[model samples]
Target: MSKNSKDTLKISGIDTSVLRIALGTWAIGGWQWGGPDDGNAIKTIHKAIDNGINLIDTAPIYGFGHSEEIVGQALKGKREKIVIATKAALNWTDDKEKIFRDARPERIRKEIEDSLRRLKTDYIDLYQIHWPDDKTSIEETAMELEKLRQEGKIKAVGVSNFSVEQMKSIQHFTQLSAIQPPYNLFEREIENDVLPYAKEHSLAVLCYGPLCRGLLSGKMIKDRVFQGDDLRKTDPKFSTSVFDNYLAATEELTQFAKDTHNKTLLALAVRWVLDQYQGNIPLWGARKPEQIEGIRDALGWSLSANDLKTIDEILAKHIKNPISPEFMAPPNR
Candidate 1:
């Protein structure tokens, strides 16, 4: 599909011309995924934009402000062409290694300012609470974001990793434009409630980890080893027996893509996400320019009912030990 073929979604009355895919900067942040080269990260951002992707999802906690900085540098003169969707509320201690949720009104105020400085933008297109903070009342967090919206600091208010009840509670105070949730073939906990609720409430749903942090990229092998601060080293899906099961499933899925669609597993994985729900945007993470090349393939085709059934059968056949991305969650405090 052409760039124009990508659909648009409206959030909080703002007309956003977004592709089916968005560029996620979590990996570029280089905190959890692995150490990322600064030059490569900036190039990846440019490549995504050049390839027709308009929305870029980032967070302050990513690399403790490194990812946003790289995004700012990449968009120095090209900011007008892209939609910036960033998150706040998750803060780090002095050491920066221990991070926790803090959506207090005062914390939100400070976070927006810091994010603005790092992103090199006066007004953010979408500002989301990185995670729900149990320490602060949801009402307080919503009111703070509403205030920021009124002040023109953020165009839309959103929340990430929030439950249905938490969403309802916040909606009582202010309008929620979107919700960011981890939704991939392996991690689908949000489909039951978060996704349906967002659709019912007219909130845009942006699903992150579209490739399950590179597991569905069709590159992981049993012998692959992760080093440094790479999260895959500790990810449950990457464990011994579990990794074998997932790898087996991925290999079958990869073969299916080659035989059925004449595409790569990366394209098939993202297309499956787009076909599963209406108005769902899959946030694709990439740390290198070459990684964005598959965006076009993911757009033009979709999965059929039979294909979906076959995919389920493949998962059931090989993945005896399935795992969710629960370890990535931040502390409630």
Candidate 2:
């Protein structure tokens, strides 16, 4: 199990230390905002850690390096206490060898160095390939990761947004310690491949988008008119009629919470993912204090058998798989 702090939840496994609940910082860097404001960004990150969250996730591509800088700023003095997980893939260019793309080993080395400088850390706790480059042999990219780990630059190696076959192929480089993918009540595609593979291999499965990109937060409604710049506008689930369908389904779950007076829709959504296994750690992203505040009620509880069956029934009736072609990261071409 885990050492339960008043604010943080810690879960340990055979391989490494796992913080059951962690702060995923993409939200503060304006994942939804055109760009996140520095003051607010600092506050939210500090608040998450202050509230006992010890792990943080970010990627170089998030806001074109802005997110990392913000994370570095937020964790200035508290660096040693926090476990940071960041990724490299889909750089400014695809030349991994050319200082841009996935081809050059030199580029990969430079990118890690640059990330270290930006992060203000001598070593990263978990370093992940943000996505796989299909152009190069998976082994070729993994070799660079192994090199980084050998240099004491990173504690563990992992991959984000990888398929089962891709993860297995990369594992040939060495034992991969973790795998990051999207998993939520609304999106369960990973259940069929990624989750089982992680379980069989003893790899950490970090579930990003645990809030379903804010849909499961119980904020967006069916008929709401979204402005042009919002990411949700492009999300199919937010489409006029489609959004209503999603809301209707969530409404049922919300009602269930009321019936027991025990859970919020956000808590139920988070608990549903956690219920899948002991290794599942949902990486929660928060934009403001309120966003983090909304999900706090979800912690410290588990769903009952009837609750689990009811959730499945609601999803089966109203939700379809939302994994679209756009959601799939394009192969490094």
Candidate 3:
């Protein structure tokens, strides 16, 4: 790809700069990941934008609106230069501790307004349903999103955590611009169908957790302990024998990166996701400015067929017990 062409991805008639990678604000929300410092989080967002990353993916549930607020503050006068992608249909209890999925018409209506306010934008570049609510018909949700699109509140409509069947059901009501799903070397359930469907339909694939929630970052150690609220504490992949298996795989993957490309496992992991599938955008999450530094290394590199085969062999050799991220799914209400 040419330098200019590689720097941007056109989806739904909007050109989003892919110069670095899309910045993910889930960690800055400071809920499941850990506590976050507002100053650091804001600086991290600035650093990402300064470094040429122009796409940001956030959700209202992320820190219960805190992430959007931070994003709004970060983009104070630069909103037009960046593309904001936020989600809806996921709400919290009155106390704001528990969260559930609700995509009813009334609920989505309220969510868009609230998200617009928190994001400090009159219109969102991309609005997505955070999850598939079992209680609401997919058509109903799609209709509401289509209504918003018509009204100019949102420029494009997308869905996250949706299956191929779910996307098909929603497509009957409105054209999908993108699909956000958890995709990385470890979690690849989408590769079977969702990916092919998106490609066939010309919908962009915005992949979340590109580093497997930091597992593929190559920073995790077997003795590491997570706080009570940390999502990884309860993640099956982090438990006893499973944690060891994953760690072993990471060790091998790290060596492969050094031997092959002289790059960090973090860069290798992100590059793997981007190269494995065409037009697959990885949402790289960061809470500190330093965490955003390695994005440069992730670019300008492509994995060869032999490199991909070696990665598969490494995964198959050490990961005797593979775990899925099913636990992160919210309850349908």
Candidate 4:
């Protein structure tokens, strides 16, 4: 990935150019992480583009479609330059209590229109199924996406949080251009399966949680008190029993980054993710411009082969029991 945003990932079917890191709008929607301010969120989006990031990813369930609305409001008059990717198949109740998978053909027909209306664009650069719906077969889901592509509603088809088998199933019916998965320093399960499949199949890997939900940002402390609707308060890794272990690992990583490369933990983490594979694209999340200023520092620098080994050693020494990001998954209908 060149350790820089200068390199772009081109989906086989999409016409737009996407940077190495995409601007994630999950926090901007603000349902789980308190609430979002339109002014700040808009500025953040502009800053990300101003700083070389041209890809933006959002979902309808993010703040119940508020994130897509905010992203739509931010890209007025300049939508063509940015690669806008959004998801469907995940729906919530009117009261916003229960979120379940709904990848039925009828549901996708309505969801795509709603997303188009909210994104303020005629066609989405990349349209991804948020998650696989067990109730619906991959043939039905993939065929529906192909139909959308035929209609020009979306340029490329993608699936997030899908296993290798599921992706293979999807390919039998349609072209799969990308796969979005949660991957970070604290989480490496995808490295064993999903990444290899993407690499072998020529699919773009849009890696989410590159900063481990801000743990690799080096700003969270051991005694930090999470306020508001922040989802970290409920993350299993942030609980009392294991928080210290992860924090300790993060602290050591912070020191190693500074001592070895004179870089902040945020920059080092992004570089690490980019260096892991030749085409890995990390999705950087932010709610304010200031939070993303460090992304530039991550560019033009590659971590050494020895540096990766050191990181694994550090994690093995400090973290006794590691955990995956399974808790963040939505319910399957």
The lDDT leader among the candidates is: 4
Q: What would the TM-score be for candidate 3 when compared with the true structure?
A: 0.97
CA lDDT of every candidate:
0.86, 0.73, 0.87, 0.89
Candidate 4 local Cα displacement, residue 184, angstroms: 0.3
The TM-scores, one per candidate, come to 0.97, 0.89, 0.97, 0.97
Residues 1-333 of candidate 3 have per-residue lDDT tens digits of 225455357778465544436999999999887776899999999999887788899999989999999999999999999999999999889998789999999999998999899989999988999999999999899999999999999999999999899999998999889899988888878888988888888788888998987888989877888885798887888876777788889999999999999999999999898886666889989999999888888887688999999999999998865677899999888
Order of candidate numbers by lDDT, starting with the best: 4, 3, 1, 2
- Report the Cα lDDT for residue 76, model 3: 95
RMSD in angstroms between candidate 3 and the native structure over all alpha carbons: 1.6
Q: Model 1: how far is 174 from its true place, Å?
A: 0.9
Q: Could you tell me which 10 consecutive residues in candidate 1 have the lowest summed lDDT? A: 1-10
lDDT of 1 at 26: 91
158-191: candidate 1 lDDT, tens digit per residue: 8899999999999999888889999988888887
The true-versus-predicted C-alpha distance at residue 45 of model 4, in Å, is 0.5
What residue pairs clash in candidate 3, if any at all?
Answer: none
Pairs in steric clash, model 1: none
Separate clash counts for every candidate: 0, 11, 0, 0
Ten-residue stretch with the least lDDT total in model 2 = 6-15
Q: Which regions of candidate 3 are displaced past 4 Å? A: 1-4, 15-17
RMSD of each: 1.4, 3.6, 1.6, 1.6
Comparing 1 and 2 on lDDT, the stronger one:
1
